[model samples]
Target: MTQDNVPVLTIDGPSGSGKGTITRLVAQRLGWHYLDSGALYRAVGIAAGWADLDLSDASALVRCTFDTDIDFQEDHGGEPRIIVNGLDATDELRTETAGAAASAIAAIPEVRAALRDRQRAYRRPPGLVADGRDMGTVIFPDAAYKVFLTASAEERAERRYKQLSEKGVSVTLPGLLREILARDARDANRAVAPLRPADDAVRIDTTGLPIDAVVARVLALMPAR
Candidate 1:
């Protein structure tokens, strides 16, 4: 299939809403390419910090974004490993600090413009499954299937606490909950590419659902290949 004809499935949601896990599983089931769009921003943030460039400097950030070398290698056993400038940045990219950096830079219109083409380049033949805050509304508006996964902030924070704890990272539930709320406000009110569901996107509440259940629900919404 041509690039234009390649199908795409977009799973958009806030951080810790289980979109990442669900998107990966859905892509694996269909044997399609996966784009962790959030990781791209995180990669940029990490690169900028290393170069001592201010996140508020749009020009510097755009340059830093272009100069950075970021790629994803699928491990199949779990999430794809993110490599930045030939270094394993997978673990670093998952930190709350990296996430906050990403959110800050993502609010810049120029930064988003610079990353737009890179995001689109992931849409290869067969199909693509994209996961991000604005995948459906902005990045992959033409996607064949779109899902907006969400849950209460309390539930999301609890989920994040569990995830971080499993990785041996210590965090307080109250602190995590506060961060989630703050992030929600920042993302939803951002001037450029604010987070919201596409008109045609399906909404799924995964508060108490298992991974398999959420994955199955999303897969059921997919168009037959």
Candidate 2:
């Protein structure tokens, strides 16, 4: 498909809302490219941490973002791999610390501006399924289909706790709940690209819904393939 006919599908939501999982499934089912925009931010955050730069320094972070050569690839097992400045950082970017740092730097206007073009370049021939806090509202406002998937804070916390535990990361339910709430506050209150559903986007509350149900609801909203 050409750029005009790329048929981008943007799934935007706060963290732990199953947007990532749903977007991957949708992209796989439709044989399209996937853009995990949050991973880009996380990679930048990891790079900044490695350089020991303060997240509040927007100018410095902007410079770092512009200079950073971040690459996203898939391993043989089909897992996403992140490379930062020619160094493999797939493991570093997945940590909670990196996630928190990403949230912090993502609030920086200059940093966002620097990474805008990089994010848009993911739109390829077969189309793309983009997932992030502002994928629909800001990154791809003209996306063919926009979905804002959300769940209750408690439900999201539970899901995150289970996921971390399964990965052998020790986490308490209360701690996870607090972290989720804090991240939500930061994401929604930030001045740049705050998290909100686009007016034209479909909203799906996955609090009591299964993953298949959410995927089905999103698929139903799409134009015929």
Candidate 3:
């Protein structure tokens, strides 16, 4: 099928909302390509930081975005392995610092434009499952299925805390909660592609749902081919 004809399932949500996990599983179950749009911004931020490039410089940020090399490969367990400049950056990409950096640059119109085509290019063949804050409203509005996953800020903070703690990262619950709330406000009020659910999107509150249940719910929304 042509690129435009390829089916897409967009799962949009705030950080720690479980859209990332759900999108990956849905893509795997359907044997479709997956796009982690948030990671792209993080990759850019991480790369730029290494080069000592100022984040406030939009033109420079756009240049760095276009110049950086970002790739994704799945491990045996089906988790995405983020590669940047031929090196494994999966761990760094998941950090709160990286997340804040991503949120910082994501509000820039130029940077978002730079990554627009890159995200769209992932749609191929059978389909694509894209996960990001604005996937449904911005990147893949034409997608066959759109879902907006959400959870209470406190719950999201707890989920992130557990994940990071298990990874040996030191972080406090209150700090994470504060950061999540700040990011939410910034993302929803950003001038470019602000985060919001599409009018037709199916909303799922994954605050206390099991992974399997959330995945099944997302998959159930997919119509039969």
Candidate 4:
């Protein structure tokens, strides 16, 4: 339900499909609040790693989720700083390692339930733009605009390579490709809130589309100013 006419636009997709960049841009244009749902899971994963907790331990993960201190700060020179348990994990959260950890944690049902309400809390007037694997399907099912952005694994991996490299994070294309494929399978097959498009979602294949074109396509679905 959209509370008090406060609308939401959900941009759900696999990693490196430009969800982060595209969603943030959309929110900025619309003057809406933004939520990066994946970051919540990533924050938990980061906290869990700091405490050395095993991923297989659901109870521990849930407890850690409750105890985790996660908050998003405004962009610091193009990169948003995420505070995880009092430490700035903005850089680490963008790594393939952090992505893998978030995927593992996302598959845990308890953790999903734990974060659902928190994600919903981001909804506010005049609106919200949320990006994540399950934002449209699960977190914000009633969103007025739902878009599933996707790209070929090779293309996405290449994009990730450039992104991380520019940020001084070393990564190889082949390794990223392999990891992306594995994460796709794991996310799609997860028992709870798997990564799949919402039935009503507008699908956009971003394989070779320019960012401006993609953003225009998404915004077209909304009421013109």
lDDT of each structure?
Answer: 0.92, 0.90, 0.93, 0.91
lDDT per residue as tens, model 3, 1-225: 689999998999999999888888888899998899999999999999998989899999999999999988979986679999998999999999999999999999999999999999898898899999988888888888899999999999999999999999999999999999999999999999998998889999998899999999998998875
After TM-score superposition, the amount by which residue 8's alpha carbon in candidate 2 deviates from its true location, in angstroms, is 0.8
Question: How far does residue 37 in candidate 2 sit from its true spot (Å)?
Answer: 0.4
Candidate 2 — which residues are off by over 4 angstroms?
none
Sort the candidates on lDDT, descending order.
3, 1, 4, 2
Q: lDDT for model 1, on a 0 to 1 scale?
A: 0.92
Candidate 1 similarity to native, TM-score: 0.97
Worst 10 residues of 2 by lDDT: 90-99
Per-residue CA lDDT of model 4 for 1-225, tens digit only, reads 446368989999998899999998999899999999999999999899999999999999999999998888867476678998888898889888888999999999999999989889899888999999998889888788899999999999999999989998878899999999999999999989989999999999999999999999989999988
- Candidate 2 per-residue lDDT, tens place, 1-225, comes to 577678899999988899989999999888989999998899889888889998999988998898788888889999778889998998777667888999999999889988898999999978899999998899899998999999999999899888888888888989888888999999999999999999999999999899999989988987787
Q: Candidate 3: what lDDT?
A: 0.93
* Global Cα lDDT for candidate 2: 0.90
TM of each candidate vs. truth: 0.97, 0.95, 0.97, 0.96
Which numbered prediction scores highest in TM-score against the true structure?
3
Prediction 4 TM-score vs. true = 0.96
Stretches of candidate 4 off by over 4 Å are 1-4, 75-78
Q: Pick out the ten consecutive residues of candidate 3 with the lowest summed lDDT.
A: 71-80
